[model samples]
Target: MASPRFLLLFTTLSLTVSSAISGSVVEDLANLQPPSDFNTTIMKNCQHNPSLRYCNSSSMDLKEIFKFTIVASHLCNESKNPNCVHSFDHIDLRNRPKMAPLYLSYSFFWKYCPLTVLSIDLSNISLKGSFPKEVICCDQIQALDLSLNGLTGEFPIESFAPLTNLTFLNLSYNYFSESKISDSQFFKRFNDSSFIHSGILPSDRNYTIKAILLLVGFPISVILMAVCFGWLCFQRPDYLPRMFQRKHKFTPSMLRAATNGFSRKNQMVRSEGVEIYKGTLRDSTQVRIEIYRGCISREKRKEFVEECKVLVELCHKNLVQVLGWCRTRNQRAIVTEWTDGETIEMWLSGSAPPWKQRLKILIGVVDGMRYLQENWPEVVYDLRINSVLLADNHEPILSRFQVGDQYSNNKKIHKFGIFLLEIITNRRSQEFERGEAGLIEHVRDNYPENLHKVIDARMKLPENMFDQAKHGIELGLMCTDQSISKHPSLNQISHMINKVYESCLELAPQNHKRSHGDGVVGKDSSNGESRL
Candidate 1:
């Protein structure tokens, strides 16, 4: 509204004043300095920490200095952030040349930026290394927003411990393994989300510990398994499969020592390729060692061992017990429990025993055959008078355990008839001339008329047993019949003998835990001959 001359003069004055003000703002910003109480530690430590070493140079830029001033003023009492609790507004603090008044206002904050920056919102800035060391150095921080930094390592509890005034801390989305801060340092205002992934749980640290344990424990487990396998193979071959199940487990060297190296003096009997020797064990138990001299191949040795397995299982009072077995490169040997007294064949060579004693021997022989045929009918044995060994009490024991499947029960029973005749008649079957009938045929042809004449002249039978003797002679003839079907089964023979001899034979304990019977016919009741 004034005249043109007046308006032009006012505009010139205004331009001069504005230029002076703009010059003052530029001068003030250029010469800005932090106050005495400022946290210079943030810059000093950040300069030394590797991650924030660039902070020192970045802080020197005027534009960044302007941004830093805004950050400082955001927490001041004079100008607090409008939305500090949830999110922060983006601030464009680039160095543009227009606003001199805005520069003067920020210059005032640049004066106190170090002291007044109690709050920092550097969230989502991709800061690293267990959070920026710059923030930890600014220990006066109260509300820190370092979320989404992807920081890792041991949690900085010691560094955070000094930040006693910290209240609104957001360290979410950071991985940390340890937290040993004192309870006093964990103030009540801290929300659960403040440390959402921050403390007291496993991170990558457990993987390292597991790797070390595996390296040490794996070798120890393998060593233990090897030791157990070795023990099982050596000490317990029976528990293994049938192919690996060994027999002749006694070493030949041990048996040699027990037999005085097979001295001729120790030899008890010898025939064909077999020999029996008297041996004494280390435990002072007597053993009769029988050896096969020519059998040497693995097949032959296998046959010998297979025979031993059967012998070991056929335990009974009347059967001679196989104590152990052994084999060498060219020999197989079996050890048996040593029984005293000679075979029944040798006994008859001397003066004939009383008829009662001979009858007892006959009954025991029947019991032994009964057990053998009933349990192992397919088994083979030499059922001859010569095979009957006498115990100390003259109880008859069959000498041969089964070795193969060659002899049949019917054939063995027919031979048993010949054995009974030898015992009663006291005559050797081989002594009869070949042109004449043998003892079996002789006894079969003659009847009760020849029974007393064929009976041993030295034997004197009791009057009550005369009829029993007659029946026994008739039974022997029946056993020798030519037809195999005519032979009595061992069970029938046992029952017939038990019926005829029940009044005379008493029971006595036999082999332990064997099922042949509860006991054997060990005692003769007729005359105090309790150990027949």
Candidate 2:
């Protein structure tokens, strides 16, 4: 057995080797194809269609790590002007036997390609159901053509509002329920062509008199059926959940009083153009209020309400619960359960936390993140040290009140990697020397060989725990890996982190023995063997 001091490092190294071997075996068993292979398959599938020649693998670098960009805009259009978009030329997968449903194949294709798909021209692919929330995470998507598809449910114009870069969208010939689309500036960019086939009759189906007679539909009976169907669809459920309904929806005046008339004394954070104030409700419930600065515009207010509806539905122990919201003609604020602990960023600015505390926080973060991915289809764009609040008991809670841009698990994984590095190094990426670049970039560049250099200077990791810390760093790298296929699932990551923690627990006995001046015994080293 290795000495207790080196056991963690040895275990980490061994686990890495085992993981690689097992990963390859799993990949083979699942018959999963690499990104390059998937790209080639896509190209071959589109070969017969001349318009889809742009689907060529050369247009995208599937092997490029950590960067996403579209290189060929002209492939979709013949116009000489670079900005001109005639049509999103490559997404027509209609009648293709090998091509899977969009939802089933979404993550597979998304991760394989280096470029964020700018224009999706899926005009004839018989897609159905509510808009696939997955596609919205592609922040760069500019044009979407879902015309002639069988899409249903409420028109998700509000969901698309965050895609600031979106320029053109066509949802014609699809089954979409009527909703207020013109209320937002985001929807205003889309014209009448976007709503062509309300998916309702006469564009939908024409019921003939003969067919109606065969179904025993008299004029009065037909009218009653139509009325019943409309009522059923409209009364199915509340857009906002019943649990979120509150009788004590605080008015702006009440909030003002609770927050000391919006005084600076109540302010908790005033960064990134966001102001958060700490306050107590009349019932003495401690709360945090996030106030959005400019007066709520008519369009913006509608979007906020819709977003709140979704936010209120989420419930997780690791997440800061959103209690209620206040919106008046002049102001908008979202209220959440308050915490006495300082921001993780603030805490990190001091001495490094104990290894156990750090591990606990990391586990909490992973749990919260996994919940977000499973429940919320959107990207966690606001994950950062400032967003993580530590309680008096040092428990970590992830918080987000406002709806922002679309982000995906891939982006979250990358940010989580940076967060891990920050916790370990006690330095912000922006604070790095100009030549060194971001934290992940610098660490990745120096990893395995010079990793010790990146550890927080103040953190004297016990020799036994050093390998555990290194193991965590490796997990961070895996999370931030450029190759999407290599990235561990949320559950896998959570398990790995917990395993490292278990190893720490296993070392406790040996450390105690050494501290008591008990000469190291073979049994002591054996007791220190990693439980993982």
List TM-scores for all candidates, in order. Answer: 0.48, 0.49
| Model 2, CA-based lDDT | 0.62
Candidate 1: regions farther than 4 A off: 1-248, 435-437, 503-532
Model 2 clash pairs are: 9-467, 379-407
Clashes of each: 0, 2
Candidate 2, backbone clash total: 2
Against the true structure, whose TM-score is highest? 2
Cα lDDT tens digits, model 2, 1-532, are: 1232221112222232233332332242244223434455334434533222134445554332111111122112221223212222233343432332622343433433223246655566667787766566555677766777778887666677677877787776777875653454554576544555554233223323344464676777888977865553333212225564343255675677778888999997897647889997766888999887677679988887777766777688788888777777767788888888888999888757777778888898899888877777653435678779898777788887456546666667777887887787776877766521467777777787887787775655656677787887888777777766656778888998899888878886766666565333333356665321
TM-score of 1: 0.48
